[model samples]
Structures are given as C-alpha cells and as structure tokens.
Target: MRNLLPLRSALAPTTTVAAFAATAAVTAGFVTAFAAPVAVTAAPAVKLVAADAETNVAAVATDGTTIRYEGLSVRIPAAGEGVQAAAQSTSGDLSITVSRSADGSVVVKTDKHEHSVAQAASASTSRANSAKTCTDSAYQLAGWKLPSFTWYYNPAGTPAALSGTASSAITTATNALSTACGQRALGLATTNGGQTTAVPQVGTTGNCIGNDGRNVIGWVAGNGKWLGMTCTYYKTVNGNKTVTGTDTALNTQYKFFTSTANCSGAYDLQSVVLHERGHSLGLNHVDQTAHASAVMTPALSACSVGKRTLGLGDFQGLVAMYGTK
Candidate 1:
C-alpha cells in the first residue's frame, strides 16, 4: 500500500525516537556510510537496477491493488499504475505511483491525494541484502501493527514550493516513505499480504508532538551552542542528508540533502526516503545490522554509502517481530 503523511516542521532543539529502535536510527545517523551514487528517473517511466553483483534481484513495486514483492520484480496493478514508482520505491525493493496532473499540467507543489501501489521485492534473497534489522534494545515492544504517523510542516518555515517539481518531489518523497518503518521482513521477506494500508493522519501543524522527531531532527542554540529534543510519533532528518527532507527549519545543520552537499550532487530520493522512513518505522540507526555502510548507518558517509538496499540484519528484526515472510 502506498500512503503518504505530510510533514510539518519547527525550530526547536534536541529530542529523539522510541527506545533502542530510535537510538539505533539516531546513533546510526552518526556513524555514517559512504554516500551512494545518485540515480535519477524521468517522468512517465519505470527503471530497474540490481546492486553490484546480485543479479537475481528481488523487487517490490506498487501494483495498484497492493504493494507486492516477488522475485525479480514486484507485481504492478493493471490500473492507475506508474503513479510514483521512483518515489515510493521500497529501496531496491518497491516503488510507488506518481500521476500526471489533470490536463497534464506540471505543478511545483506535491499533490495530497495518493494512489494505491503494489510492493515487490526479492523476498528470499533480497531480504538479507536489502534491509538492516532493528537492534536498539530500547523500544522492544514487538508486534506494533501499522502504527500511524502524524504529519508536520514548519510554520515559520513556509513550504518552499507548493506547485512545481518541488511539490512533486515532496509527494514522491512521502510516498516513498510509506515503506518507512517497514514491518520486519523476517529474512525470507514477505508482504503486508492484505491491503493493510496505514493511513496518515494530520499532525500538529506548528509543533512536532511525537518523540521520534525531536531526536532525529537535531537543532542548535542561539549562543553558538547546540541543542536537541526527544520526540515520539515525529519525523526527523538532516537536509544535508537528503533532498526529500527539508533543511531542518529549526536547525540548518540537519539538511536532508546531505548527499548533495559535496561535488556529487545527486538526489537519491529513494535512498534518502529509505533512511528517513527508517526513523519513521521506529528503527533507530545501527552499524551492527549487517555491514557498517548500510543505510541504517549512524550517518550518510561518502561514496559506497549505506547498502542502498535492505540486508539480513533488517530481515531478522522484522522476522523477530512479524511471522515468516
């Protein structure tokens, strides 16, 4: 199911996410991995790529009916397909839909309505390679079903754009985020099975009210000092980290487009969303999931960064929570 929740932002200080899960995500953000090479997608098309050597790639895509994951390719629904494929991509796992505006008009802002999408991924081989397991012993409350996310946008920080590629980018980013905080893939990998789409609800417009956001989105003090806050049911990211996420309205330090910070300016929106969504999924940053460069890494390092795909550690965590895939 491809769903999206809008985000609101604020200029506060230090905070964080749930127990160990949040801790791992937060911590992993610090460790950092080699940045991934950016990939781009043109409008009205679907693209595929398998990492380094793994050929028999498992993929997840929005098939309209449901997000189906299968071998090689995920199932795509026959109707209303290709909505936001690149944006909702399940990190080499799945992608969502992005439709052309009525009259084929191009708007700068992201649209609010959403289209259904199928999730496809390499269930067997892809699981271990695509994701990282959640290992922060802190938020160990397993079996959390489709937890909802509260959206926020910074009040002081008005939307940079509401009707163009910027808005399209925002929608694509959030649609990709649907897979954030994914259910543990259980090594073998599995789908949500039924269309158990976790709907997005309105969040506090002015203030981020959850524990998750406070910590993920770091802030600073007026006297050249740094500050942070803890949050639950919140969204956080470093703009320098990815473009999908905005420059921290409160903290310029936390730029979502961190990958774009250097000469290698590519907006790997899928990867960025993958990391940010991880925070949303309640998984904290981690270095021990599989390898250190995983997207779950404490931070986004330079070239050859995070797995750019899910891995075994991530599946283990999902399997631990949900049953077999």
Candidate 2:
C-alpha cells in the first residue's frame, strides 16, 4: 500500500509562512548497488524523544503517531509503511520531521529555508558576537548514520539552468559530507552510479516513498516552495534502529548557481545540496537563529556559498555521530 500523508497538515505553518508552496505529498528518503536486500527486524511501541531545541530531537518516531518538535513536525504514516523522516527547506526557515511505520521502523525529513540577502545580513550582524564566541557550535543528532553506502544520480528531470553543472555540484556536496570527519567515511563511488530513471523518493509536496533499497538523488519540480528535501528510512537490526535507505530531491522551482563568483539572486546548488546531504547522513537542523553559519542550520541566504564547507558545530556533530575515521 502507498503510505500517504498530506503535506499541508504534516508541515505546520511558521509564524510568517506555510510549510510548502506546493500541494500535498505522500511517503519518505538512500545507497548501495546490486546487493540482496537484508531482512529487517521489527519491535513494537518505540517512543521518541521530544525536545524544544533543535540539537536533541530524534530523527524518527516508531510510536505510530504524529509528533512536533520545536520547528519540526511529522505526521503518522499509513499502515505497512517502513520508517521515514524528512528535512524541508522553505522561503522562511529550515526544519525537520519524522514519522513512524507499522513495522516498527522510522522515517525522517529535513529542509533548508531560503531568506533574502538583507535578512541574512541582519541576522549575521545581530549574531556577530555569538558567532565569534562559537555559540554557533550546536548540532542536532538524527540517530542514524550511513557509514558506507552508494548513491546514484538521476538527472532526468534536472532543470535547464543547473543541467550543465548539477552533476559536478552534487559530487562536491556529497564529498564535503564524507570528509567532515577527517576521513572518507562514506563509501560512495568516486563517480556516481551514472544517470538512471530512478528519481529521489521524496515527493514534490514533501512526502516520501518507502525504502526501495536504492539510494537515488535527483531533481523534481517543486515550484520555488523549497530548496531541497531529504527523507531517511530506518529498520530494526539487532534491537537497534539503523538507517536502511535515504533519498534527496532538489527543487527546480528556484534558480541555483554553481559558482559563488557568478551568483546573483540565485541559490548555491552545492551549499543547498550539502545541507540536504547532511540530513541524509543523520544530521538534523540546528537553530538558524543561533547557528546561522552551520551547514545544519535550518535556513540559508541567497548567493551564500559558505555552507559548501562545514562549520564548527557541523563538524563536531558529525564526529559525535560517526566518530572521526
């Protein structure tokens, strides 16, 4: 059965903006190639931690109910669905959501919100003292990791503007995530699995598909509502919930630039992709109000390229989760 959830109800409204600019959505998000699927173990009635701050929120909930965490919210899933979580980007701020599945698995989603240059500048000015003191050194733990996984690119629906450089930009984005821990923890192919018909499982309206046992990343029509979205799926293995699949979708609604020098009013593809990739790797959104420079922060500014590199908190959080290689 298709695990369905309406986007409008799932992603709650911020004070100033709605969750997504598009319509409703369906289920969840990643890697490896040509390997036989591993059987997943299931346990019942798992409760997730709910916190008001961004750094301590659990990425998935196996309790079979909807949940809200500060800036994040997730809806319950249809029966027979595996776990999934999502990270979403908006015109206002970034946030994350998680859902429970019938089989005791979980899902997570995350996004990066977009902001005007003026607003970005003002935020920086106000946080200047904080940034200097390393107050930006906060990161969220999504409770899962992809120690080794293979991801593929599906450029079939890539936007015309990003077509020329999307592949290389994605490569750089994923690489940044891999090396943040001081070693090549991600076992992705130096070159991706090449283009395929498989698009990311994330829906245009911010829903996701169940784990299909493939990790695909690509573009889709999102109509400027979001910059990028990531969905992560988890399964019980030896009483521990481990990530089984993840997928990322880049919205074609907004214009994106590959080069900082050439960026004008457009977003930076690598920066946005890097943030989304952080979600895929089990990093939740830090509070942008407090950690504006961190890649895991919930919002981003137009023409910003700093996110292409991990900030101090981003690095520490990654090390805390995956440990330094």
Candidate 3:
C-alpha cells in the first residue's frame, strides 16, 4: 500500500524513508557523470559497522541510515507488476515493475537481470574507479566533482515487487543508506573539522563546498519532495533537487524507483542517495583497493555492508574538503 509522508522537515525520519519525502551532486566542474584521474589506485575493499539493526555505516562507504528515500509510481504493464523508480544507473541491466491493488494502493517490484559487485570491477576499472586513492589530487572536484555513476540517475538495477516484503526491504535499504551517508558526512566534518555555526552556501540551497559544520543540503524539500517532483519528469526539469544543504532530501513524492527484482538489498536507494549527498559535500569517490574501501566506491554489494559505514578514507576525504578536526 502507498504510505503518504506527512508534511515535515527538510529531512524527515520515517519507517520507510523512501515512502517519505527524500532528496545531490554530480561529477564534473558543475556536476554530471562520474569521472576520475588518469592515475590509478589499488583494488577496493570495504569495512562495516553496525550502528543499529536498522542502521549501519561505512566511513569508507559514505554515511548511514540517516539516508532516506520515497516510493514512486510506475505505469509499466508488461510483466507481473510495474516497478517504481525515478532513475536507473546504466552501470548494469535493470527492470522495474509495480502492481496496484483495487484500493488504488501501489505494489512495486524490480528485476536486475545482471548487476553485481564483480561487474563493478569491470565497469569502472580506471580512474573511473579511482575512488581508491585519496592522496591523488587529480580526483578532486572544482566547484563539484561528479563520479562515474553520477549521472542525473544512472540506468538503475533490477527492482523487486513494491508490495509484500519489498516495501520493508526498500525502507530498510533506504535507512541503511542514510546511515552510511551520514557517517561519511561526519567523516568529512571530522576529517576537516566540525561545524559550529552557519552553512557556507550563502543561499537557502546551493552546491556544497565542504562540511563546515552545517551541511550543504537542500531546502524546497518537504512532505514528499520526490513525489511532488512528479510533475517535472521528462519535462526538461532540473530532475530531482540536486542542491546541497543539511537535512535536505529529494522530492519524496516525486521518486521514480528503479527496478527491484534482484535489488533486494543489492541496491539501496537511500544508500545510493546518501552516497550522492556525500559528493555534494565536496567528497569524491575513493578509488577501489588500497586495502581500504571508501563510501565513494562506484559499486556497493551485500558484502560491503559494513565497509559502507563511513571509514577513515571517507573521513579524511571530508576533512580534506572541510578541514581536519
């Protein structure tokens, strides 16, 4: 069933954050796709931390359950059920489905025919996967540095049914992402320093410079920001709000979930968003390898659950942008 989010804060805490309003950055001088320096780093690895049953974080992975998401309405009628997803990362094969009950309630699902952690290895093998090396300055962002999968929304992976356990799974996955992203934010703050005063953007919503104390999240976010953005899809709109600020989320009501079939925990929407938010904070993806896994790794896997919780590399990266504590 569809869970409507109540009008709330810039970032509201919900059982199903994806069912709640949720809300980033990109690579490039402005922000577009994920790119990396010509240099290289070692392979990538991850470490994990259990923040709570619902939340886990990886400093190297990004942040944590502080992440959030929203359920999207899909209209595809080909397979079993139409899926809900705003965007899909082209990183691999993905399908979406959703089924509506007579009650006008929505049940979503996805099927990632082919998407895996090993695939990430082959997909982004160069500086593209350079999130492994933080010491390399070539992997820096000017105003904002976009990552390889930093497209507005990459061709996402397979999706699962929205109803049944899918919703809970989706919600859990979202929370996990928030936790991971949150940790990375802290990592940035801790590495560079901690925030004490105002946000540095100078505007209600703007690009993130680095964690000064206050986050560079967004503002127009409320209720279900993602849901509200539905009116702008495929209309040359700005897509989802990509600004930076603290506690800001995407158009909750406006989310268009990617497929969910194999997505189960394979792909955490909230976690993915949380990772993106990290980039907005001026943190870039750490190359894979280095006997360390970064929150910025291009791909995420179940085995990476722990490492996804902010790690030292992630913290230091944030520090590099903001200041070291």
**Local distance difference test, each candidate:** 0.26, 0.58, 0.28
Model 3 quality (TM-score): 0.29
Per-prediction TM-score:
0.30, 0.65, 0.29
For residues 82-186, write the lDDT of model 1, one tens digit per residue.
Answer: 211111111222222122222421111111112222322211112223322333222211112222333443223212322223223333443443222454323
The best-first sequence of candidates by TM-score reads: 2, 1, 3
lDDT of 3 by residue, 149-209 (tens): 1112211111223323333333343233222322433322212122223322211121112
The digit string of per-residue lDDT tens for model 2 on 81-100 reads: 33444544545544555544
Name model 2 segments beyond 4 Å from true. 1-84, 93-96, 99-137, 180-191
- Show how many residue pairs clash in every candidate, following the order shown: 121, 29, 128
Ranking by lDDT: 2, 3, 1
Worst 10 residues of 1 by lDDT: 222-231
What are the root-mean-square deviations of the candidates from the true structure over C-alphas? Answer: 23.2, 12.1, 22.9
